[model samples]
Target: MKTAIYEKAGKITVAEIEKPSLQAKDDVIIKVVRACVCGSDLWRYDENVPHEHGDANSGHEAIGIVEEVGEDITTLVPGDFVIVPFTHGCGHCDACRTGFDGTCDNHPGYQNFGNNYQSQYIRFHYGNWALVKVPGQPSDYSEGMIKSLLTLADVMPTGYHAARVADVKPGDKIVVIGDGAVGQCAVIAAKMRGASQIIMMSRHADRQQMALESGATAVVAERGEEGIAKVREILGGGADAALECVGTEASIDQALGVLHNGGRIGFVGVPHYSNHALGSTFSTNIIIGGGAASVTTYVKDFLLDAVLKGQINPGRVFTQTYSLDNIDQAYKDMANRKTIKAMVTVD
Candidate 1:
C-alpha cells in the first residue's frame, strides 16, 4: 500500500507502507475512496507546528467503503458507504454522554487519526462511533454529491459549529471572517439559520464567488483594516455576530473588530493567538465561544439531510481535485492560495 507522509515544511511524499487491517474487536477496515487536504494539515506542511523528519500517516478527512468490521461492531457492515469524521468518542464517557465528543476522555481522540487515509485503506479503531452511513447507497449519489458529503467529515460541521456557538438567529446580520472552505460553509450555515444578511470577508475572486454561491449576501474583498471597514460600512456598523474561520492572529482581530457591542462571536479556527489576543475581547462585551467542535456528536444529522436534498452544496469549495498519488500537488496548490479546498479522488 502507498500512503502520504509529512516530510518537512512545504513537502509531502507518497511512500510504500504496510496495508492496515483491523487490530481491535471494535475496529473496521475501510477502502478509502476520497480524501481531503485540510487547512490544519498545512500547519505541519508550513512548519507552523513541530515536524520531525519521519514517514508517518497524515490525513484526517476521508470517505470510504467498508471492507470488514470487527466482531464487536454491529452498526456497519461490508459494502456500506461511510464518511469518517476526524473525531470520535467512547459512548460511555461523561463527556460523550453529555455530547462533547471532541473532549472525550475515555476513548481515543480520533479513529484512524494516527494513520493517513490518502492510501487505499484505513482501519477505524472505533467503527461504530467513527463512521456515519450515507443516507443512500453510492448509486444514489453523483460524484459531486459524494464530494459534498465529504465536507461533513469536518469543515461543514465546523462552520455549523461556529454558527451554533454564536447563536446565529433568524434575521440576524452576520459576518464570516475568512474565505476558506470553512468560511464559505459558515456563510451557508448562517443562511440556514435564517440570517437575513451574511457578509463574507474575502480577498480572492474565486473564493468571493463561492461565498456568494454559499449564501453570503455581501462580499468584502479587502483584507486587514480595510476589510473590517468594508464590513462595518456595509452592515451600517458591525454585524450582529461574527464567525471566525481563519485561524490566525490577524483573523481573530478582524473577527472581533467587525462585531457589534454585545455581539456573539463563534471562533472555529484552530487557535493561533496569544493570551493577550484572547483577553482583548473582554473590553468589547462580545461573548466569545468555540474551539474544536464536537461535530461528531451534534452536526452529522443536521447536515446529512441538507447535503442529500440539495439545499446546501458545500462541495463547491472543493475547487480543485487530484489523484491520490498526486497528493503533494494538492497541498502545494492550497499553500499557494490557488485552491479553496483541495480534494483527492481515489480508485
Candidate 2:
C-alpha cells in the first residue's frame, strides 16, 4: 500500500505503507480508483503550514470501488463503485438531516479516513450513511465522466455550497472570488441555481476561459480594489450575492466589495483571515454564511443525477492528470498553477 507523505514544503514523497482495513463496525475499506490534489493541499506544500511532518494522508478527495464492507453497512457492498466525500456523518443526526453532514453530532469533524485518499486503499467511516453509490463500476464510465464524478467528492459540492448559502436566486447577479477549481465550480453552481449574471474574478487566461465555459457571464482579472471595481462595473452596481471561494483576507474583502449593502456572501474557503476582518459586515447589513460543504447531501439529492444526465461538466477543471507514483509532481503542478486541478489515477 503506497501513500503520499508530506516531508516538507515543495515535497510529497510516496512510500509503501500498511493498507487500511475496517477499524469499526460501520467502516468500509475502498480501493481507490481516481483521486486528485485539492487546492487546500497546497497550504502545507507551498506555505509550509505547521503540521506533523511525514503525514501519510495528504489528499482528501477520491472515488473508488468498495472492496470490503462492514457488518453494519447495508447500502453498499463489495465491488460497489462510490464517491467518497471528505466529510460525513450519521444520517439521522440533526445536522445530517439538515444537510450539514460536516457538523454531524455523532461523528463531529468527520472527514475521509486518515485523509490518506491518494493511495491504493482507505478506510471509510460511516459507510452505511455517507458513501454515494454510482450506477456502475468505474470502468462503466468514460474518462471524462470519471473525472466529473471525482469532483463531486469535494470541489463541485463545495462550490455549490457557496451558492447554496449565499441564496443565489433566479435573475440574481452574483460574483465569485477566487479562480481555482472551486471557483470554477461555483460558476456552474450559480448558473444551475438560476443566477442570471455570474462574474468570476480570475487573472489567468486559462482559468478565465474555464470559468466562461462553466457559465461565468463575465471575468475580472484584477485583484483587490481593481477586481472589485471591475465586478461592480460589469454588474452595473453591487451584485445580489457573492461567493468567496478563496479563504484569504484579500479574497474575502473582494467578495464583500462587489455586493450590495444588504447582499449575502457564501464563504467556503478555508479560513485564514483575522477574526475581526468579517466584523465590518455588521455595519453593512451583509449576511455571511457557509462552512464545510454538505457533500453527502448534495451528491445524493441532485448532483449525481445532474452529472449522470450530462447537464454540467464540472470535470473540465481537471486540466491535468498524474499517476499515483507521480503524486509529488501533481502537487507541484497545482502549487505552481500549471494545472487548474490535478487528477490522479491510482493503479
Candidate 3:
C-alpha cells in the first residue's frame, strides 16, 4: 500500500508501506477511496514546529470502503462505505459520553497509522471510535457528490463545531473570521441554525464569493482593527456570536473584538502558544471554547442529513483534485494558497 508519509519537517513522500490489518475487536480495515490535505497537516510539515517530528501518515479526513471487520463489530461489515472521523475515542468514555470525543483517553491507536512509530498501539484511532458509516446512498447520486460529503468528515463538521460552541441561535447575527473551508462551512452552518445575518470577514475575492454563496449576508475584506469595525458597523453594534477559523493572533483578536458584550467566540483553528492570549479573553467576559471537532459525533447524523438534504455543499471548497501519487502537488497548491482545499483520489 502506498501511504503519504511526513518523513520529517519540511518533507513528504509517497512510500510503499505495509497495509494495515485488523488488530482489535472493534476495528475495521478500510481501503482508502478519498482523502484531503488539512491545514494542520501543513503545520506539521513545517520544519520550525518542534512537535512536527517523525514520519506520520499525512491525512485524517478520508472515506473508504470497509474491506474487513473485527469479530466483535456487528453493526458494520465488509463493503460498507464509511467516513473516517478525525478524532478517535472510546464510545463509553466519560468524555465521549459528554460529546467531547477528541479528548477521549481510551481512544484506540489509529494515530500510529500515520506515524513511523514502532509501537504496536495505533497512534490515533484506527478502529475503536473514530469511524462513521457513510450514509447509504441511491445510485442517482454522482461520485462527485459522494466525494464532496467526505469534506464533512473534517472541515464541514469543524465549522459546525464552531457554531455549536458559540451557541449560535435563531435570529442571531453571526460573524466569521477567516475564509478558509472551515470558515465557509461555518457560514453555512450558521445559516442552518437560523442566524438572521451572516457576515464573513475575508480579504480574498474568491473566498468572499464563496462566503456569499455559502449563506453569508455580507463580506468584509479588511484586517485587524479595521475589520472589527466593519463587522460592528454592519451588525449595527456587534455580532451576537463570532467564529474564528484562522488560527492566527490577528484573526483571533479580530473575532474577539467584534463580539458584543456577553457574546461568545468559537475557534476551530489550531492555535499556537504564541498566537492567542488567554488572559485577555478571560478579562473580556467573552466565552471561549473549541478544539478538534468531535466529527464522529455529528458525522453519522447531523452532517449526513444536511448533505443528503442538499442544504450544504461543502464540496465547493475543493477547487483542485489530484491522484494519490500526485499528493506533492496537492500540498504545494494548498501551501501557496492557489487552492482552497485539495482532494486526493485514492482509487
**lDDT (0 to 1) per candidate:** 0.82, 0.90, 0.76
Candidate 1 lDDT, 130-248, residue by residue in tens: 57888556667887898898898888988988998899999999999978888988999999999999998877888888888878898888878898888889988888899999878
Each candidate's clash count: 0, 0, 12
Report how far residue 101 has shifted in candidate 1, in Å: 2.1
Which one wins on lDDT?
Answer: 2
Which scores better on lDDT, 1 or 3? 1
Give the per-residue lDDT digits (tens) of candidate 2, residues 1-347. 98888887888988888888888889999999999999988987898566676565778899999999989889998999999989876889888888888678788766634678988998887789889999988888999999999999999999999999998999999999989999999999999999999998888999999999888998888888888788778889999999999999888878888888999999999879974565778888999998989889999999999999999999999999999999999999998899999999998
Backbone clash pairs in model 1 (N, Cα, C under 3 Å; residues 3+ apart or in different chains), count:
0
Q: Which ten residues in a row have the lowest lDDT in candidate 3?
A: 115-124
Model 3 Cα lDDT, one tens digit per residue, 1-347: 77776666665677776777776677677776678888777886654555433346577787777778787776677777777766776667787787767557575443324432111112223464567776563234676676567787689988998998899999999999878889989998899899999999888999999999989999998878888888888889988899889888787788888988888999988875476566666666889898877777877658887787777788898888888788878878888789998888786
TM-score of 3: 0.90
lDDT (C-alpha) at residue 143 in model 2: 92
**Model 1, TM vs. native:** 0.93
- Can you tell me which runs of candidate 1 are displaced by over 4 Å? 48-50, 53-55, 92-94, 108-115, 275-280
- Best candidate according to TM-score: 2
